[model samples]
Target chain A: MAKTTTPPDQNGTKTLSDQAYQRLRSDIIHGVLQPDEKLRVEHLRQEYGVGASPLREALSRLTADGFVTAEGQRGFLVAPMSEEDLADITRLRILLEKQALCQSIESGDDAWESQIVAAFYQLEKVEESTDRDPVEWEVRNHDFHEALIAGCTSKWLRRFYSILYDQHKRYRNIALSTEIPRDLHQEHEELRNAALERDQKRAGDAIEHHILRTAEITQRVLREESLQKKERA
Target chain B: MAKTTTPPDQNGTKTLSDQAYQRLRSDIIHGVLQPDEKLRVEHLRQEYGVGASPLREALSRLTADGFVTAEGQRGFLVAPMSEEDLADITRLRILLEKQALCQSIESGDDAWESQIVAAFYQLEKVEESTDRDPVEWEVRNHDFHEALIAGCTSKWLRRFYSILYDQHKRYRNIALSTEIPRDLHQEHEELRNAALERDQKRAGDAIEHHILRTAEITQRVLREESLQKKERA
Candidate 1:
């Protein structure tokens, strides 16, 4: 869990562009940078205290990653969010994650089980704490899910999983609220148990249902938020 | 089909970096650039006749696209190839393409069917030609496949398909030999017929088998090449 959130000092080998890419990606996912916001190189340079060259490089990379959209010479924008986009992301996550979970169940060793236990335990600690930050909770939750698929040997599948997961996280972060709709901890526990038991079908069903359920909640939240915005308008 | 192969003069909106990215990606996929080859920016700048800034930006974007890998400050390299990677890419292509094909079948309009017909026609024409370039065949084949899933509404699914298809193309190009391993024309025809008839299961199975069979051939080629290298050593 400690490895999930990096302190700035730990980035010794990271180039300035890599650092900028991480910062920009996190800001976009966490909603520090609003969706559809124009990213002017000059303005971002001042804001991030990064030079223009590295900033452009970072934005180019993020464009490839789907976090940013390049608008030709006009520069980039934080990719916009939509209900359909969230649904698409959810669909992909379910498809890829289910396959990955089944593979992990087949191949996961004792160390894999220990990682899952540790990740889930960390997530539970955060969930049980009343004063935990939402960002911290999101990080822990991400690590827990990552741990489940850590044993999958297919790099391509894992890469797609990472991309879809990040996109899902973006939607989750944007639609996040204080309302606790589902028993998240229970869901996590079920997923962990299913994986540890090596029940591929149960694990697959658990993750699919978990992701679909989360998408439903997020979609509802998005709808209500859009309606509120309309009312305000 | 013409849109699949870009003519240099028509790239009006493309920046120098975009040009570099396209050139480098095509070279890598076509095996003009060998796997694990170091991409020295200074050498590439001389060869590509592009400035350093845009070249670096292009390389950064390619890194995210998985065609090139950045090694901290050590610069970039063409991503390596392996039997496992081709297997993984084929597996993912089957999963995502099958879904996309189904969605396209469900949602496709008359226009979508027409596009498929046209693309298939072009592909057949290329296949029947006596002096057709392999690159031309690849382009038509790509367009034909693209036309099949053009009606799928999910942008994310299409994006993943594009990525996986490109990676698969890289493997296909590298393992390419003059050997006619299978009747590719017959397979394409079956896929077209299934897609046009909206037979989801048949289309899905056809594509799954098609991709798997191609992977088997590519794997055999890679194995034989490695063996030849060992003999030379």
Candidate 2:
């Protein structure tokens, strides 16, 4: 239900296609639409309050981003999640995150450091708050990590990292539960300290560990969920 | 004008936006539309013989792929090329490719090896033939390289690699000249052999050398071209 501001096109009116694209993308990412779910244009038209052309256009864009899979003439489906896909995404995440971290450390100035610190402080406050909203925490978490790589000047690298991050997010969303015990606060604080201190190696290693740990937990949760569904069936 | 055989939508007819997207993407990749050139929608509508709506949608999609840049309400422009951009692109290509090569080697079966052999044979034939059609060579060359990583099971890695390849292609296309000598045939042959033999390290190193050599040569040529233009100005 987050109303992400859509950047307008030339005529100053946001295109119906852009609106449809943003709505569908966020819905898919936030797990409102489940993985492997069919994305019928007619249903989407009624759901998103858009016409067929704009909906199809939006689905095409999502297909390119790996968020939706095209089923020949059958329309689109939300991209399926699997352990193999997660491994691919997380492994590349480590490499790109290291590259981003090292570049950020080398190129970041006082302003960049302060920005990162501010982001982390906000995230920590949200984490420690009694009335912590999940959506707010997710946004803060995304911002804190974005701040980490804000100094890497490669638009292409950042773009790929963001896409892969979203793909990974889809998996993590469905797997979220209270049972997995990770001291994410301690991990974030350590990562923030290393980053601020300009310790590239420590920061890089910490990110790899953090990502891999989360991937491991998510894989277990996903598998368990699948098993429970099967048992109920 | 290579027709890429556009995959049909639900209607069995390609959307106008898709047709526009492919044309613009190929034009940008082939350097027909120069980098940094403003992509005026009214002008493009006339140029591509498409409607305003579809053309804009296509531009938005290309913008996401980094082929075009959206300048807020000012609309889109062909993404500009620079030495720094090339460096960022080539460096990531090296890492992702190495990973792809290793994974492909481990996962590829005899079928994969045969596919590489077939692609390389066609490439070598095209290279040695009297009719040195640039477009044909370009397609064959793309296929040859794609075959190298065909065994890699990671869709995310392959997807990123493909995007970077297109971006790198834009640079190579603009930098193409009769000067700067590289024994591309020998390099391709060695790469093919390594891939068939399942020599991950050798294949990885070969790819690194091949990519770096091209990057270095392209950088020099681009600088020279810029200097000559400045002098003429």
Candidate 3:
């Protein structure tokens, strides 16, 4: 599993709770832990090979991260995914990403350009490879997008962008195999070229379209799945 | 102290950790707990009359909320405040709040207008009073702003606006006593009127100006305080 985007501590160590938090977050995002699933402390403790204290601490942190929902004294459950949430997150991603992209294009230095090129190259390699590990693609794809906005000076915008990106990823992962065929590589290529050329409007539109396209596909998949579940019921 | 904006759960009962979370969050926002201060689990336990378990859980949650910073095994500390952070947060608040305000004004019904009027009435009552409690003003002020945006259909936008508003409050609280005199009540009235008239541009501009005006005051106060501290050092 890819470690969380959050870096290690100053001393380069991950505490047990931190480890648990990352594990649980990764599981939730990857759908290993299904949405709305109960996160029983006993079950997680045995599953994760950790004690109850660390597991509980991890769940508490995840609650704040929106990966888990606290049920008063009843304990915690994985946050449910829905079409409304996906749409909301996607809209936000478009808003913040466009703002950040504009800022990056306006003030990005040569170093920023190099970073974007390097990240995109790595991502493109993985995309072109015959055997693409979804996990590797996830990391590389995230890195490529992060590079695009690395020049935005606003920390708060960047922070929210990261959060929205991760939340959107949960939906993206669920729709990965189920999505309609599209030229994702071409989409990224257009974004990269526009960003590198400092074409703010083009870059912004590319990103907005990219995000909306995925959201549309994901929403459709969710709708179909829910309908099938209803029929089964 | 005002209860958190987060409503109680379905059971209408808060867990011990939830209680601790509210108290700690309030204290931090009110500056009763100093920024960057080490949150000794033992000290917080004694101070809040909660057990270590609940306190730890609260701290964990607060770290996610950005009210506290987790320092690995060293435990958590109150999140530090700075002029730069305040500026970043204020900028985000403006962006999100304006988006929400425009949407609300565009779609608001009579019920939404009534909410705004009621909240404004309560806020004005406190603003016009001689013996105004800052705590009461805070609650009413939050409600008034919340009411203006209540008509917005996008829950994600509202959620982010709330988060950014509370984060900005930490700075606003610190500068409350030191800020220059301004007609805050008048600003709100302008916003309320604009919103009620369904003037999207006017309401958006009013909120933008209102937030920027306070941010300017708070930034100046923070700058002067930092200078004084430097001189003393």
Candidate 4:
């Protein structure tokens, strides 16, 4: 779980740009940087205590990842969020995730099984805690899902899945869900059980339903928030 | 079709970095830059006739897009190739392309249908001519496929689809197929008609088979080439 939160820091090899990349990625995903906010290089340098070159390097990389948008010479901004983008992310996540879940179930050995268990255990700890931070919960939840699919050997699939997950997380963070509409624990347990039993179809269906439902719940909340803002305006 | 080839260049606002990004992307996708080859900053500076800053920025962006690998202080390298990667790319492509095709079919307007027709016509023109450059055919083929899914309103899906397409193109260029087994023309026609007719299931199945068969053919050719090289060694 700890490993999943921040990638293992490659000591002696982490360049300044790499540091800035990690910082900016965490900041964006954790919602410290708001959606569609301008990411000026000078301001970021002052905020991150890093130099201009590395900050530019980080933002450029983020731009390529779709986490940040390059506004030509105008600079970069946090990738904007909307209902449409969230729905698209959810659709792609369901597609890629189900595929990954199926592959992991078929190809995962005992070691893979244990990783899933460990990840689930950590997530359960966070879920059961009443005082847990939303961001922490998100990280733990992310680790569990990632662990479930870690057995799949396709790097490209995993890469795309994680990118979607992060983008989705930025949305999830901004619009926090206080009351999940589904049997969240049961859903996770069923997914873990189906994968463990090597019931690939069941696992895929479980994940697909889970992801789709989450999207619906989040979108409803987002719509309400926007409506409230409109009323205030 | 032309709009699909390169994302309609932002009129007059294409920065030096943007130019470098496009140039390097084209070179890597078209196999002008070989895999695992070093991308020295100074050489690219001279070759691209751009300052080092923009070239570095371009490479960093490409690194995030997975076309190029950044090697810490060792600079960058063109992303390496492998059978595993091509298989993953093909699998993800089918998943994404099928979804996009379904969305396009469900929501596409008359304009979308016309674009598909026009793109197919251009591709046919190139396919029928024996004297055309393979690269030109590649461009037409890309546009035709892009036009097929032009109606999918999901920017994320389209963005991921294009990235996968570019990565797949890199593989296609690396292992040029001397003998294509699939009826390439028929596949394109089916894709075009399926979209126009709004036949979602057939479109999905057609694209799945098309992509899978292409993958098998490319993998076979790649394996043969590697084996011959080994034998020579």
Using lDDT, give the best candidate's number: 1
Task: Report the C-alpha displacement of residue A147, candidate 1, in angstroms.
Answer: 1.5
Error of 2 at A198 (Å): 3.4
- For every model in order, what is the iRMS? 1.0, 2.7, 1.5, 1.1
Question: Which structure among the candidates has the greatest DockQ?
Answer: 1
**For candidate 3, what is the lDDT?**
0.87
lDDT of 1 by residue, A34-102 (tens): 899999899989998889999999999999889999976677999999998998899888999999999
Share of native interface contacts recovered by each model: 0.95, 0.30, 0.86, 0.77
lDDT to native, each model: 0.89, 0.85, 0.87, 0.85
Model 4 lDDT per residue over A1-233, tens place: 24556555655437988889998998998778988899888888888788887888788899889999988678899988789889989988998899998888888999999999998898888877778666677778888998899888888888888899988887777777464534577789898889889998899999998888788888988999889989998
Can you write out model 4's per-residue Cα lDDT over B1-233, one digit (the tens) per residue?
24456654654547888899999999998778988999999999889899988888888899988999998678899998888889889988999999998999989998998899999999989887768677788889989999989989988888889999888887777787463534688888887787788999999998998888778878888899889979999
Better of 1 and 2 by lDDT: 1
Query: Which regions of candidate 4 deviate over 4 angstroms?
Result: A1-13, A133-135, A177-183, B1-13, B177-182
Please provide, for model 2 over A1-233, each residue's C-alpha lDDT reduced to its tens digit, 9 standing for 90 to 100.
Answer: 76568543543336677778888999998789998898878887888787987787677778889898875446689998887888889999988988898999999999899999999999999988878777788899899999999899987789889998888887888788444445689889889999999999999988898889889999988888889888999
- Which portions of model 3 miss their true places by more than 4 Å? A1-13, A177-180, B1-13
Candidate 2 displacement at residue B67 in angstroms: 1.4
Better of 2 and 4 by DockQ: 4
lDDT of 3 by residue, A117-195 (tens): 9999999998888777778988999999989998999987887787788888898777665535456899999999999
Question: How many Å off is the CA of A190 in candidate 4?
Answer: 1.4
Lowest summed lDDT across 10 adjacent residues in model 2 chain B is found at B6-15
All DockQ scores = 0.79, 0.36, 0.68, 0.69
Instruction: Residues B53-114, candidate 1: write the lDDT tens digits.
Output: 99999999989889999998799999999888888888889999999999999999999999
Model 4 clashing-pair count: 0
